[model samples]
Structures are given as structure tokens and as C-alpha cells.
Target: MELQQLFLEAIQNGTMEGFFKLISYFQTQSEPAYCGLASLSMVLNALSIDPGRKWKGPWRWFDESMLDCCEPLEKVKAKGISFGKVVCLAQCAGAKVEAFRSNLSTIDDFRKHVMACTASDDCHLISSYHRGLFKQTGSGHFSPIGGYHAEKDMALILDVARFKYPPHWVPLPLLWEAMNTIDEATGLHRGFVLVSKLHRAPALLYTLSCKHESWVSISKHLMDDLPVLLSSENVKDIKDVLSTLLSNLPPNFAEFIKWVAEVRRQEENGQKLSEEEKGRLAIKVRYLKKFSKLKGKKKA
Candidate 1:
């Protein structure tokens, strides 16, 4: 069934699935000129794309380090990433993506396509942004839609450039006009599409490894923080804290990295860790028992 029919039928039959699909999304952080990449990241997470893959042997992993982010966006020099570049990079990352840009596509056709695409959980959609739908001054931009609200004729746009715009409930008709506008940069239409991972298992495991790395990352930061705490505190309980922390250090940094990567796969959703992330993770784990503290001593 097409999304338009699905939503209509769901509403007629009194079901809510047609209107909502909860997914994760994050704002573009630090990379001022990477909204395309940021939008890609949001869609990847929304669809749970793992971005990692296995080699021919199924035992060896493909080296993800060779994936140059900027190389794919070759058209983007100092300007924002073009829709074409976004498609290229996403294809490299193993995403199933398509671009919708045709002068022949009428407003009604786009309305149905957008409604069908955003109405399903299997679909992850993103498109260009403007001040009218988003209330932002800039017109040519990229963002994702969480789902659609048929009753209200609104589409939930999960804007990736969160620093500049919060997510909004945009009317589908208005958003369609925004998507159809010609981009002078590429002379292409601005619209979103459904994105999903080509490979499932490895990507999921890769995601899990990230969460594990976060857990391990906290312990690694303790390496830098512990020394400071020990030196600055006159509190007598400090010795016990130091002893406990030191004892918790990984026996060997390399071994810990190997062990963490090896075992992390068994973790819920975390089935694998990238060799690059493993190396960096190990570097952070090195000297987990070391650090300094300074304090101003005020006489009582």
C-alpha cells in the first residue's frame, strides 16, 4: 500500500502507527560547513546504519579510515555541500539513497511521494530547508522529517542544524514548495528520501561498540582527573579513593583494547569495534593510573 493510502486507511480504521516513528537525531556540532554530513549522520542513526562492513573472508574487516569525508563532497570548496555530494558520500557509507530532482515532478506528485516516504518507519527522509517552513533566513539547506501528521497536514522535520533551528511541525504543502525550489548551486530540486543501511549486522555492532567506548571513555578520563584530585584534596579519605582508582586501571593498554573490542561484540547491539577506533581507544587507556592537582591553601 502507498503511504498516502496507508495513512488514510490507518486514520479511517483508528490506528496511530501511520503518524509516528520515533528515531534518534543530533545537531551538527563543531563542523560549521558539514550540514550535509550532519544530515547524513542523523538519517544514519535514525535508520541505525552501522557504517562498518566485513571483507571477502567475513573474518577480516574493511578499513573505514580510507573513507575521506571531504573527498566525496568534492563540489563543496568553501560553500555548503550540494545534494549530489550528499548522495555520493551516503552511497560510499553503504546507504541506500536516491535524489528527487525533476522539473516534471508536479506539486501533487511530490505531495504523494513525500507522504508515502515519510509515512513509513522503513523510510528515512531529508530535504532542503528555508525560513518559510523553518522560519530561518537561509533558503537552501538540508534536514530530515521524523514522520507526518495527516490530520493536521503537517510533516515533522528533524532539522540537523539544531544550533540555528529547532525541529518543527511543517505543513506538507508548504514543505513541498520548499523542496521543489531550484538550487542555483546545482540547479537541482531540494527534497528528501528514505535512507537505510545496505548491511545490517555489522552496522548494528558498530553502533554498540560506540556505546561501549563511551563507557570505557569515562574510565580513561579518570586517568587525567585522578592525579588532580589526589594532589589538591586535604581530605583524609583521598588515599582510599586513589587506591581504588589505581586498582581499576586496565592491566595493559593494548591488552585492554583487544579485550574490550573482542568482548564488546557480545554486548547488546555492540557486535564489533573498528580497528582505528580500537587503536585510538587504547591510546586513551594508556597510563590510566596517572595525573596532578593544584589548590589554593587558605588559612582558617
Candidate 2:
């Protein structure tokens, strides 16, 4: 909806906290197809997420250029990013993301999410929708939902493409209809993403890998088989249990053991480690010793 046509008075009574927070960080797309990048950059800065690297000479900020970790800039420039790619980029930048495609979601469900995001100052929403439904001049576009007029049921879209259009209010049902359309690039329905700050945890020495081809079986072995094998009276020696365990693990498991040994050597050489790191290393060392014992049993 056009700015003149929208009831601006209703927005004051509705949720305006998110709108106020986002307005200061609002940015225009650098390139014609940089709507996703610009929208994400605005949300990231509004949430006070540090980019951890300098954008210009001395300033560390989130810009369209800084958001190329997930998809290369050249590719995103040639063809605009997909809904899933936006989610990936947001997550890589340490923002918590909850994405929903119109195809996989109901209008009622979308309304609830829209209301929740607009109600809080801690989160913001970015909608990916086709412009045809809005009678606009583009295909798929990305824009942040600054606020929602509850009584009017209209959402304020802070359009990143400032040259083409101004920030306007769109009706909830009409916006949902626009998002329900498919993007030719992804062959999936356009959608919206709720972006918020990720609550970080203390760094760990090691993390589980699910990228392995046999990850499903590996996880099952760790969860079910390993416990039973450890407690089994039929297991005569620890070597037998170790053998059973090692056989289930991927071949790259040895590489992890090698890495653990390297860390131990570093510690022996007077390298300082965090208490959490040291504690985790100790557990791995104990497991390594068991494997060593199993190897010695095999040699005998």
C-alpha cells in the first residue's frame, strides 16, 4: 500500500518498537539484486551483532559486501539469492534464523509469526515475496517488516530497493499471497525469515560432525550400541569393546586421534589452555589410552 493511503496514526497504537530499532539501521541495496543482503545487513546491525571484521578503514559493520560467506557475491548479483540461501547467510553471521515458506506454512501460522516478531524489540522479520502480487515492478524481493498495524492488519515493509519504491504498508493477507508465489531460481515458494541474536555458548574443544556420509549409523552406534557393549559381561577384554567401537566409526577417526595427540604435545610444551579445553582434552586422552591398550593387545 502507498504511504499516503496507509493509516500512519494506527502504527503508533500498534507495535512500533521493532520499527524504531530497525529504522536507524535501514540500508538501500547496493546492487539491483542485493535486496537480501541489504535487508539482512539492516537486521544484523539493528540487533547489535558485531560483524567481527572491519567493513571500511576503521569501522566494523555489516554491509552488503560483508555478507558473502554463504553465497558468492557474483552469483547473488547475477541471480538473486534464494530463501534458503538467505537463512544460511543469516546463520553464518551468528544470527538465529527461523524461516518459513508460504508453501509449507498456513496463512494463520504466518500471522502469528508476524505478530510475535513485531511485538518484540529483540527480533525482526524479513519477508521474501514476489512483487507481481503487490503490482510492483520486480520478481522476488526481500524487505524487512518494521512493524504491524494490528487493527488495520497491515505490515510496514522497509523496502531495500529505495530507488524503485518507498517503504510502504502491505496488508497481511495480501503479503502472504505474494510470498506464496514460487521463485523461478529456487523452484520453491517465496517466504519470510525471523532473525534474532544467537545466544552464544562457551567454545568447546571438539564438536560432533554430522557431515559424514554414515553419520546416521555413527550416531546410532554412539547412542545405543556403545552403552550396551560397555556393560556387556560377554566382552572379555576392553580390546574387544574397543574393536567393536572403532569398526563402527569412520576411517577419519584416526585423524581426530592424531589431532588430540598434537594438542597434548602442545600442552606438554607449556601452551596455556582454558579450563574447559583442558577438561575436554583429559577425557579424550583417557579414550586414546584405551585405544592404545587395544592396539597393544592386538600386537601381542
Candidate 3:
């Protein structure tokens, strides 16, 4: 199938069947290079989230910029090595250990490969717990990282688990523990528990680490139970403040009511953080640059 036809069908069908159909076609092509295979794979994985017909707003996030910034093969030549040779070896049918091991020369390349596959719909849970605080930058596009993929991924997981898993596997205590970890990690654990009982995983993890407090720590937790939260609701009050603001939020404030409600509920429940919260909670945030980078500025 043609790429344009696949995109059009994906928009109308709301099923990623066409996307994967094209991916399989690409994967089976003779002498397919890693660039083509990897690029198609990323697009297939992303479009499978079904962003909805009306929500085609920022679908381009799945394009080349994402690949250039996050794909390991793109960084192969950056280390004074030959990208051509690497791509050639990757295309070969041989499973030679030396060839694959050579590709791990740079830490960035190694991590980017891991980032490409982790947090996918196949092996992990997609985050669905919404904080309900949407920021309107008054810009034409949404925040650099904002999208509907999170909700779509979660819905897909729930649909599968509801029919696939047994009753025992869907117990609340297991989900509650996962939810607790996500909450401490993201302050959205309560939302996870309230939203889904099957699994608790953050939708956007390492991809948005550029906006995180510590990219290293955030990267470490990419596959962990911790949740990544983003809301589209309008922010109304000070309670809606994010632990990290990617940028200055717009004047619209109604989007944060959901987060405010969660905070109020947690307070009412006496859910005060213990020792873990004291030590780890502070590190979870992506500290504001003006405060952290400015000399002699206090860390409040």
C-alpha cells in the first residue's frame, strides 16, 4: 500500500491495521536498510495509538525530527565511525555478535535504541491517569510534548486486558501498589488507581526527558512503574502548577481542576508521603532552569 493511502486510511479507519500492513511490507523488502526499517517501525508504533480523526493536530511529532533526535542509527556516524558500514551490517541476515556489538560504541546510540522500543503497546502498560490540567499557550500548536496518544494507548491496553486477563490478575492491591509507585514518581499515582485497574505505566517517559529534572534518572525509570502525566484541561488556580513547566502556561486556567481535585482528595485521605516521598519526591521534578541554572538562586 502507498504511504499516502495508508495515512488517509489510518485517519478514516481509526485502526492501525493499515499502518502495520505497510510496516510489514517494508520489513519484508529485500535489502531493507536499518534507516528505512527503523523509520517505518517508529511510524507504525506511533500511528497505532489512533489519535482520532479530529485530533490530527500534531501528528507530525512522529516524523523525522523524532527519529533524528532519538534513533541510534542516526548517531552512528557522529562518533567518527562509518554509518554506511553499520547500516550494511544491520541489513545482513547474519546475527553476528561482533557486528551488533560494534553498534553499541556510543552511550547515546545505545540509549537511543533502547528508547525506540521501550514503553510500547506490546510489552508495557500505557499511562491513562489524567491530571486534567491543560495548558493553553495561546500558540497555534499545543505544548511541544502534548498529544492524545497517551489516552489512546491506555484505552487500547484496557480493551485488551479486560478480555485477556483473568480476574485474579486484575486485583486492586497489585494495581494499587503500581499506582502508588507512579504517584510518588509522578504525583499522579492517585489518578492511575482511579483510571485503570489492569496496569499503571506512564505514556510519555524518556521522550520528554528533555523537560525532566534529571535526564539520567528519568531515563532510568523509563521502563519502571512510574507514570508520566500531561493534561489538556485549563489551569485555573495556583494548585494547578506543574512540578515542571515546559514553558510559561497561558492565561487559561480551567484545565487544572482535575489535578486540584486529586490533590484535595489526597489531602482529605491523609495520604501524606513517608520517608520515600521525603527523599525521592524532590528528585522527580524537572527543575526550572532559571532557578537551577542561575548562580546563587535557592532551590525552593
Clash count list over all predictions = 6, 0, 13
Instruction: Name the best candidate (by lDDT).
Output: 2
The local distance difference test score of each candidate is: 0.55, 0.80, 0.26
TM-scores, all candidates, are 0.52, 0.68, 0.21
Candidate 2 lDDT, tens digit per residue, 138-233? Answer: 889999998887877888899999999988888999999999998897688888999999986644444332323355555676788788766763
Tens digits of per-residue lDDT for model 3, 127-159 = 221122212111110000001122222111121
- Which tens-of-lDDT digit does each residue in 1-300 have in candidate 1? 455664465456333332344343455533555666676766665565554433344432222222344353333435777777777767766678766764555667655655676656555666664555546666677776655656666666666667876666667778877776777877766665557656544321223222223445555656675567666655368577766555444433333343343334333344656797566545544422222111111111
- Which is better, 1 or 3, measured by lDDT? 1
Model 2 clash pairs are none
Which stretch of 10 consecutive residues in model 2 shows the poorest summed lDDT? 204-213
